[model samples]
Target chain A: MHTATHSGALMAETTSTKDAEFGAWMTARQPALLRTAYLLTGDHHSAEDLVQTTLAKVYLSWDKVQKREVIDGYARRVLVNENNSVWRRAWKRRELVSDQLPERTGRHDSYDEGGSADLWAHVATLPRKQRAVIVLRYYEELSEAETAEVLGISVGTVKSQASRALATLRATAHDRLGLGEEER
Target chain B: MNHDHDDLAAQLGRQMRHEVEGLDRAPLSLADVKGRATRIRRRRAALTGAGTAAVLAIVVPMAMLAGQFTNAGDDVGPATDPPSVSPGPTEPPDQGPVVGVGESLDTADLPIGDVPAVTWLENGSVLHTADGENIRLEGTYEDVVRYDDGWLGIGGGLAVLLDADGAETGESWVTARNLATGQGGDVVLFVADGELRLHDNVDGETTVLRDGMPDTAEMIGVDDEDTAAYNLVGPQGEPFAALNRDGEETIPDPGTDAYVLNDVTEAGWVSAITQLMDDGTCSRTVAPNGDVAGETCELMFDRFSPDQRHVIAGPAYADGYGAGQLAVLPVDFTDGDDPVLELLQSGARDATLMSWGWEDDDHILVVTATPVDGSTDMTWQLVRIGLDGTVENAATPVRGDEFAFPFALTS
Candidate 1:
């Protein structure tokens, strides 16, 4: 009976330590991690899914990850890769979304709410790379090099992507920008 | 009037901040965290189980014999199969790495308008699967964008992309075959072997961002696409002049009088070029970094007139807060060329400006968010300002939890 009791205590101790470690990682990365998830899903619903999955995955390896300072980077990479994987096999379970703009970018343009949605909608039409670039760049405020490191690519690619992304955004923006137009 | 555009941009910036401020923060959930770990473990067990492996051995041969993993049931990822490094069959050497090419995920069949199927080569080079079922775009680049032009840009027109086998890839607002797509969607840039290439996505072509190499690789700028106007801040603010397509680099000429300083924040520098037509001298106020342990105050300015007489200095703050600086500066400048420098607005803590719009060069329509004490509630208030320094506050019907940060302003 005493042995069983002692063993039970050991188990509880292990659980607590694991819990503590998980909490530490969570505290450090919760803000940045959630942001990545939101950018990936483009909506809060799926972003929640992505972040949750990442946390859960990281939690399982709490003890192992606690030994490293790169836990935050590991968690973020996991979140992004997982989100991309979901879309990779999305062919089978693809849901058709409207060509209309994503109405839920949090706020609308009353002067041209109609145009804001259209811009985002066109943004939605962009390739994953383009979408990811805009989100990481504007929303998260990461640098081209940092973003490249996160996304894992060359800096040249970042430039090319920006050019294309801006061109696309410029097309939608021309009507709304109300400025001296420049010829392409 | 250059102020007209600045006013318009300021309004858009305010709105974007508001949208960001409106995002709902998810409540913390440790139980949820515990649950995820449990799920991943169980899946790993299932994948390694005797029954699963035995079935896989037989299924592989059968599928190959039958022409493919033809069944849609394969959609369920092997319980243990997530987060695995999926380097595609043909991966480009890391020498000229593709920007943001991390773990390979399943490709999507997005409608790439005019292009054929777009397949990210196992290599860094992207494969264009044209209508003829051809996979090309290989051997076309080496050290992609080596010291020259390695990245490709497809401007505003629709670009159709296909995979190696004619699968529809997603379209691009623009594609930075390498650079711009990373952190700053507004600027595609790369810094390798001491060379820095910053390109703007103003159109399909990639233009040099700021010339010169930054001490660090942090790019701080956002795609305010509407203006073909976005702001960028580089690490250490080592000023590099603009790069023209003629392959010329504008060396950073800190004219003792006019120079760029990026020491305010590690996020790089903030350069707002308000009006191109302004004969006015523009200015930026930067508070020295590391000097403020808590919150030392500073200001930023955008000069648009001459003689330091007409500059748009700010009530802006340079602190790290959820909403961009509250003490946003109102434009106050002179009409001279004698290196204009003036104090604008002091940074405020409790103030939140959601969006700002301009009725004219003089008037500003500011959208602001004010947090209520003890109420856990935030309010969005609209205020207007004039060149004559007249201020008016108005309430709008625009209020909700969905409003996001960096709410954009419109003219």
Candidate 2:
């Protein structure tokens, strides 16, 4: 939405026309947003929900992010924050029980054959924070600094978490894919 | 980067693409997203408007008033006799001007307000107004509740007891997380970090009701008998545990399939039972024996009235859709599934009902936007609405440095 504020003014005048631009931008960027969300959350349904929620938030604060460059970053931050909050609630609710087992494994079954699938599965096995860092850095191709900003953590913490995640993924690949063990 | 790790990154990126490729491109449309965003924007606008109004009404006036009083001596007025109300069945007479800032609060008549009431300023300074006099309690407290004699302020991981004079009598570092006071007794159920500590002021004693409660266990409320209801989580922290008032060691039944439990009443409990329909939320008021007392097609059943004769249920929506209005539902409604709902307040073009608290048996104190004419910027005002739909301004719009909520009323 195009909401222009006069200098030293308390209220910003909002225009409905800005939504058209925002809508167009969203339509173009949604695929990339969906991919990031999908990697962040392993489920297709959760990915859609996260994207929709993030878009809604971005649309609400569209005025503040009118500067073209900041919109994607804002949306990513919202997505990551929303995901973190959901994860916190799930953890508090104890819904992260890996042993209870899901009722349907059909959704997870599609990506089970290739080495790509093996690597993805290993990525999924990592803790939420580490997985987020790995996805933002390697998949989203965001810088370590950008990843830190997105996750609201220190650059050093992001480095350590990504390093730890990569090591775990490598070890898992050796055990599951029968890859030759490499020197650390 | 190492070649192995670089290969793994490439593989991961390919897998992520494959994952996205398998998914549906459009689960929901941009139009649908825009609509949802519009609704969310409305809510945000309402909040912002309300906040702006609060700053204008409270903050600006307080600064001016403080400036005027700086030259004068800082002397608090003497205490006066408490307002007397004969024991009978009638609503308490409107206590004259509860708490206000700036010109709204005529400092010459300071402390000349109703008694047995507690109000706090923006800076967390609590005013215990009684007998037409006020006692200023200096300190920041996260939460405060009125007890039999004084008020109990809980904050900084400690629970402190202040007497009628707003003077601290007792302080304990019990990690007082949440406190629930029941109807009559001097008993208070204090849920610590992971333990249930029951404190009785009558005997001046404190005892542990149950220790080693699951860290995830949340204390909801306590009854007159000191039986506390907790929203228990499963071993995996799934909100699948039953809403049962039990001792610490007693295992909560996981047999109930209710997804979320709402309020606990002496009669039974209300829960949002998952349904296999359009708007999958179904609310049911059930008895303690798991007997359904009444069921409704409502998204939420928020709070039960003090008398428990009615429930403060939601924004008048047909099949779970709308900005929603706060309504009062009769506790015993079996005449039909769709009964006449008593709407407490409605959302205006610029203002919306933010939240509400039961001030007394007959009055529901609502915090909502005060609609300003011809302007989108609205102010927040605490309104007390009677069961008969009578609206009265409960608190004087105090102008202060920052907006503060009338968190709780102790009377």
Candidate 3:
């Protein structure tokens, strides 16, 4: 208990030293940030990448964060940028592999025990933007504006992405997933 | 009654979250990354060891050459004369005072919106959505960008950027009642349309940023005196390609353009631009390296999700959250297996979707057609996809007429 208390102080000291505002900025925001990143990337690794990148970026701007408000907005923006860069590389790699000879499906998740195996199976099925939007808006409970901040977009854009994402999830829930029968 | 749909959705969220992996830094310390960053110190470290020596050898000549050119590349500070690329249309100097000169307003009764309509006005001026009757904000708003609230009692974790008279700031509208009580310190108003919009926060009155940038009002992060803003691209209404302050239609340089901004993580402002282009269906054109879509690579995704998942859509990362979901889709095994988003929820459907309608909160109106036999078109037969993460072949697909679209609900 003493160690916990001390480490809590240490953690605060470290983050505060890194960016005095960061301790105040993301006091209890790690878990939530992780969740938001997870939803956006659909992969835990990618989500963590986003969160860490955000933290690092926040560290650099510790002063502005404390002097001005909206430190959270700044951090969220960094996370969104990191996530986008990831898929940009992915899309680029996909382009390079577009010409590769087709290989038979050998690693389908139907047999994988990893819960994420199935979760990602569904997430991958979503368009990248909607998936990111969904995680920020619904899971993290950020409003359209906040989501936009993390993602660096307009409120209108948030509404549009959410609408599109909702529709797709709804449809997939109904037909492919047969969600209606379960609710009965 | 099976509550499997809710169970599955919740489970998926939980499991997927639990399964996430963090960035493997291996053996680096937080101190290490910091040390590395400190070593680089931006432009100072940009000059490489070899490049530094090479420049040293030619430093005398380069300095003389630099004198000829207006320090195009100065001591890593803002250059006096940046290399000009394609020039854009130039407008006359902004013809207005940068700040309000003792202008006053009695915001106590500024016709602000009441509860659940127009949100309270920030700085005791302007009406927010809390009181707006059907999204009413009078005349031309030069620009707008949204911000995520770190739970600061702003608008649902985010604040809408304010652009009027050429000034830029971010604050959410409050209800009439909340405005009276005050949100925080001096309302810490920012610049709007070249005017000062102040706010009161825990701290006393603070003038955030002044005369920030012209025609380039955006969500700017300030460091010391260096502040970079992500320019809002693709002006709405008229489609005249905006020129930067220099009146250059094309981007000043590759980095300034707002295309594929989401793709560049180093630049912190990409998320803001991402949302601007992410206006539901507004498409953005930018390269992965965060270059202008026009020059580097013209790749863009929907500003919003395109009612279906099959089409190659990028993550709406640079924008906000609250949109996107999981759906059970019939595995498409065709020539170009683009999985069409079937109806599971009305919210997810694009306004243009015909085969989908809403059934309830979690489910939507679905139209299935005999599993789309070879060469057959997807017809209107509504079905349900559950959230249980279970898939069972439909016994019989339903008809489209049994559905209802709120008419107001369109992609």
What TM-score, to 2 decimal places, does chain A of model 1 have? 0.67
Which number leads on DockQ? 2
Q: Where does model 3 exceed 4 Å of error?
A: A1-32, A67-70, A86-120, A173-184, B1-28, B35-411
* Candidate number achieving the greatest TM-score relative to the actual structure: 2
By TM-score: ranked, best first: 2, 1, 3
CAPRI band of model 2? incorrect
Worst 10 residues of 2 chain B by lDDT: B99-108
Taking the tens digit of each residue's C-alpha lDDT, what string does model 1 give over A8-113?
A: 9999999997788678768666766766676556666677777888888878766676457777767765676566444321111111111112222111122365
- Candidate rank order under lDDT: 2, 1, 3
Q: Which candidate has the top score in lDDT?
A: 2
Interface root mean square deviation per prediction? 18.7, 12.8, 14.3
Candidate 3 per-residue lDDT over residues B1-411, each given as its tens digit: 124333443555555555544522333235544553464344233332222332233223322221222223334232112222211113322432111111211111112111221122221123343223232233222122222211122221122343332123444432110111111111322333343233333443434333432332222122111222222323321111111211122232333222222211111111112211211111222221222121101112321111211112322221222112222221111112222232221222211122222222222322232212232122232233222211221223222221121111111
**By lDDT, is 1 or 2 better?**
2
The lDDT values for all models are 0.37, 0.51, 0.33
Write down the lDDT that model 1 would get: 0.37
Model 1 ranges off by over 4 Å: A1-8, A24-32, A67-69, A89-118, A175-180, B1-18, B49-411
- Score chain A of model 2 by TM-score against the reference chain A: 0.75
